[model samples]
Every structure is written in C-alpha cells, then in structure tokens.
Target: MSTFGKLFRVTTFGESHCKGVGAIIDGAPPGMELTENDIQPQLTRRRPGQSKLTTPRDEKDKVTILSGTEYGITLGTPIGLQVPNLDQRPHDYGEMDIYPRPSHADWTYLQKYGLKASSGGGRASARETIGRVAGGAIAQKYLKLTNNVEIVAFVSSVGKVAMPFVHELEDEEPVSAEFYDMLNNISQEEVDKDITRCPHPETAEKMKETIMQKSAEKDSIGGTVTCVIRNCPVGLGEPCFDKLEAVMAHAMLSIPATKGFEFGSGFQGTKIPGHLHNDAFVRKEDGTLGTKTNNSGGVQGGITNGENIYFRVAFKPAATISKDQETASYDGAWGTLAAKGRHDPCVAPRAVPIVEAMAALVIMDSFLQQQARKASAALLPSVEIHHSLLGVPPKK
Candidate 1:
C-alpha cells in the first residue's frame, strides 16, 4: 500500500518516529541527470520548522541519494532516497500510549493491525509524505526534461480566509480570465514569498493571521491547495475506470488530512446548464483542437486534452493539536486527552509541494502508460479495414 504508480513505481518506507523515511523509485529512465540536489528543494519546502506558521520541529530534511546514480546519471535501477528523523521526540507522544488522539489514525491503526507504533502517529503522520515529495521530485524532473511540464500548487484558502476570486465565484459561473491568467503564470518563487503560500499577497496575509489565531487557541483550521499542471501531454489517462481525474483524486486524497478533491469546473459545473457548461472545441494555431472554456479541467472522457490540468485539495485541520479533548480510550473508558508533539495548525502551506508531488506522480505514471501503448502499437503492422462503415480513406 505504500507503493504507487505502474511503470514509474515508488515504494515509500519508514514512519513518523522511525530511524528515517524515504522512497525507492523503480523504472526511472536510465542515464537521466540525477542527484541529491535535484530532489532536495521540494523536501526542504515540505519539511517542518520553515516559519512561525508551521511546526517548530527542527529538521533539516536533508536528502541523501543512497544509490541508483553514477556521476549524476540515473542507472535505470531503483533510486534510493532517505531523510533521517533527527529532531523527532518519541517522548512527546508518551501520553498518547493509552488514549487515541481524536480524529487521528491511532485507534483505527490498532484495530487494523492489533498493534500500533508507540510514538508519533506511525505511518499516519504527514512525515510519511517526505518520501512522496522526494519521489515526486524525480518524476517532476523527468516530466520537465521530456515535456517541459510544470506543476505548481499554492494554498488557495486557509480556514475561512480564501482568495477573493475563489470565494466570489457564483455556482454557475465559469472560472474567470483573471484566475486562468494567475494559474498560467504563478510560480513556486511567488508562492514561497509568503509563509502561507497563498500566492496572492493580501490573501496570504489573512491566512497567516487565521493560522496564528488557531495556533493560539491550541486548535487547528482546515484549508485548500490548488494545483495546476501545465504543458501536460494529451491522452494520458485510461478510458474507463482509470480516468485521469479519478487517479488524481486518488493521489491527492491519499495524503494525510485530505478531506476533499475537485478539478476543473468540479461541483460548480453541476449547477450550470448543459449548453453553457460544455467546453466547446476550437482549432488552435498549432492545428490542434483546444477548448475555448476549460470547464472540463483539461480532461474529457478520462483522457487529457492538452490543456492545463488544475484541481483543488481540501486538507482537514491537523489532528494532533496540543489541546485537551473528551474522547474514549481503546477500552471505551472516557477521559480527557490532551495531545502533545509539534504539529501544524494549518497544513495547506506545507501541503503545496506534497500536492505538486502527487500530481507529478499521477501525471508521470499516466504519461508512461500512454507512452508504452504507443510504443507497442508502433511495433504492430497496420491493417487496412475495408468495411463500408469502418473503412478509412486511402493514404494520400
């Protein structure tokens, strides 16, 4: 279950308080330029102790490339990556050994496995995403080098503080041109300028204030991260059960604390009339068809349409807040449970890279699957169909 993807398989290991956590990436194309440097930036961005808005758990989150590279080139073997749990304090969670934290995985994990990690949330911690971020960084590199694809995610809303554009959209209204323009041009640098990572300066300020208020209350607040994948190749998703958006939703919701996922027009499209909601196609200057309105979110009938793929992921507030709560223990004994340990009051800012990484994983896996189909089809001889209904015109 720790593994994800098909051709570009990644298996993540370790736990929140384990010796270390990382991923092993298999099926990476051989001879691509790779090194620890290529993967560290994303990990750094995802790591704790970044700012006052985030957990103060001091961790370098420095990655080490253990194998699968020679002279900075991939060897087509499994690439190994790891980041140690240097600042982890297993003692901080000592009290949780009895009562499970409310809304956390502590109880379910025990029910499923009959036992659980004594410290931290075990595999349920956001620390599990370190491996995902590292693995996604490599997938991102391949996507960037091959197709010039770019994935950017930013905190769009924190608690009730959302960007004016996002909160103001009517039920039947399509995303505005200004929103599209922002999606087309926003970069990680701009997102990183503010601790809240909302990209919009004014919204980021409000989000920061909201997070601070929640942290002060020893409670937490939930928010959303919006991600866009630009320059995605056409025809990446499967036709039926494995729709592009379906797999993307799987990937996004797999991250800890995620509560919801939506892409393109998403729920908004349901409120619009079919005539107005449809994305009418228009031929581009490049001779390929493009949609005038992207209400389809760059995908139609489970396949990509060579447009920017965008989506929003909602992350529930961090569960392990340092506040007292009324909850029952493993044996149904009710008691007050006050959790300890460093945790984010709001997870959307830190979740940005994780969202980008998961998006890359989905896109990379889909692209590789599409590429395999094309390669295999290229090897087969072409057959001329002569049926009146199905026959194609003869080659010019």
Candidate 2:
C-alpha cells in the first residue's frame, strides 16, 4: 500500500512526527543526471510556514540522497531519499490521543490499527507527501528531458473565492480560448508570484484575504487546484482499467484532503449532447493532426491525444481548526474540544506542488510503460508503433 507506480515504483516510508520520511524509487531510467538539488524545489514549495495561509511549522525539509546515483547520474537502482522531522510537538497534539478530531484520520487510524502516533496523523499527515514530491521531481526530470513535457499546478480557488469564471463554461460549449492560452503558458514561477497561487491578481488577493480572515476566526476552508500537462506524448494510457485519466484521478485522490477530481469537460460534459461535446479533428500546419477543441482535456479513449492535458483537484479544508467543536473520544464519549498546535487555515496554496508532483509521477510512469511495450514489440516489424499512436516521432 505504501508503494506507487508499476515500473517507476516509489515506496514511501516514515510518519509525520517520526525521525524522518522519504521514499525508495525503483525502475527510474538509467543514466539520468539526478541529485538532491533536483528534488528540493518541489519540497520547498510543499514545506510549511511559507505563507500566512498555511501552517506555521518551520521546517527546512532538506532532502538527502542515500543511494541509486553516482556522479550525478542514476544507476538504475533504488534511490533512497529522506528528510528529518524538525518540528515535532507531541504536547500540542496530546488531545488527539484522548479524542479524535472531527473529519480527521485520528479515529479511523486508531480503530484500524488499535494504535496511533502521539502527535499528528502519523503516516496520514501531509508531511508524508514529501516522498511523493521528491520522486515526482525525478519523474518530471525524465519526462522533460525526453519529451519536453511540462506540468504546472496552481490554487484555483479558496473557500468561496475562485478564479474568475474558471468553470463558467456551459456543458455544450468547448473550453474558452483564453483559458487554453493562459494554461498553455502558465509556469510554476508565475503561480508562485502570489501566496494564494491563483495566477489572476484580483482573485489571488481575494483568496488570500479569505484564508487570513478564516484563520483569524479560528476556522478553516477548502479550495481547488488546477493543473496542466503541456505537450504530453500520445498513446500513453492502457484502456479498460488503466486509462490515463483514470490513473490520474487515482493519483490525485490519494493526496490528503483531496475530495474531488475533474479534467477537460469533466462533469459539465454530462449536460450537453454528445454531438456538440465532441472535439472535431483538425490538421496542423506541420502536416500533423490535432483536435480543433480540447473538451476531452487532451485525452480520448483512455489515451493522450497529443494536446495539453489539464485537470482540476478539489481539496477539503484542513480538518483541524483552532475553534472548539464537538467530537467523540476513543471510548465514544462526546465533548467539546478546541484543537491546538499549528495547522493550515487553507491547504490549497501549499498543495499546488503536491498536485504537480503527483501528475508528473503519473505521466512519467505512463511514458516508461509505453517505452517498454514498444521495445517488446521490436521483434515484429509488421507491428509498428506509429507516431500518433505513441506520441514520439520516428527516430532518424
């Protein structure tokens, strides 16, 4: 259960308040230049105390590579990475041991294991995502180097505040050209410009104020993260069970507090008839082919359509609020409790990197799986893996 991916497998370890947490990445391609530096950016973005909207736990989260690389190059072995827990406050969370916080893993974790950590959600904490970010960074590197693929995620909304008309489209209509252009060029640097990471200046300010206001009220709020995968190669997903969008949805929902997942037309498509919802095929100037509209979000029939892959993930508000709320103790006795210790007013701002990392892991794993399938088919010349089918041009 701790492991993710089939070929590019990452087995995560450690708890939130444990000595450390990290992952062991197996099946990464050989001969890629990788080091601790390549992984730290995403970890830094994911770390707490960076903004007023998130938890104020100060952690450097410095990652260390213990194996699987030499002289900056991967040796095709398991890469072991770790980051120690710097700020552990068992005293602050001692109340959780007595009673489970509402809408948290405290109760269920205790019930299932008959045991629990003295502080935090232990393995259930968002801190556990450090390994995923690190491993996803590696995968992102591979994907970028090989295929020019780029993945970026940003806070789309917070509480009642959302990006202007982010979901304003009708079910029958295709995505707007403005959104396509905006997402096509949106970068992590641009998203990092504001604390809320909404990209739009006015909406970002509103989101920040909402978060700060909620924090002042000793409450919490939920939000959404929109992610885009630009220039993804085609024919990466396996149909039936392992569709590209399906794997992506699974990866996203696995993140802490993620409540919903949608891509392209998503739920909105159900409102319109299939005729108008369909994306018509169009030819490119380079004699290539692409869809005139990207209502399918660059994926069709469980496979990449060689267009920009975009999606949104919905994250619930942080379960732990400073305000008092009624919840049951371990023995089922109910009482009012005021949550203590550091927690985010809104988790969406910090979750931006997590969303990007998870998406990267999915794309990278899909790419490797496609590569393996191609190599296996090399014995039969009659079975040709086409450019449109595989999203890779024939090598000269």
Of candidate 2, the 10-residue stretch with the lowest lDDT total is 165-174
lDDT per residue for candidate 2 within 257-335, as digits (tens), equals 9999998977776778888889999998988899988889999999998999999999998998999898878878888
Best by lDDT: 1
Model 1 error, position 197 (Å): 0.5
Clashes of each: 0, 0
Q: Give candidate 2's TM-score.
A: 0.95
User: Any runs in candidate 2 off by more than 4 Å, and if so which?
Assistant: 170-174, 381-396
Q: For candidate 1, write residues 1-396 as lDDT tens digits.
A: 999999999899999998999999998999899988899999999999999999999999999999999999999999999999999899998778879898999989998999999999899998999999999999999999999999999999987889977645764676777888888999999989999998888888888889999999999999999999999999899988899999999999999999999989777667779898888989899988899989888999999999999999999999999878999877889988888889999998999999999999999999999999999989999986666655446556
Alpha-carbon local distance difference test for all models = 0.91, 0.90
Model 1 weakest 10-residue run by lDDT? 387-396
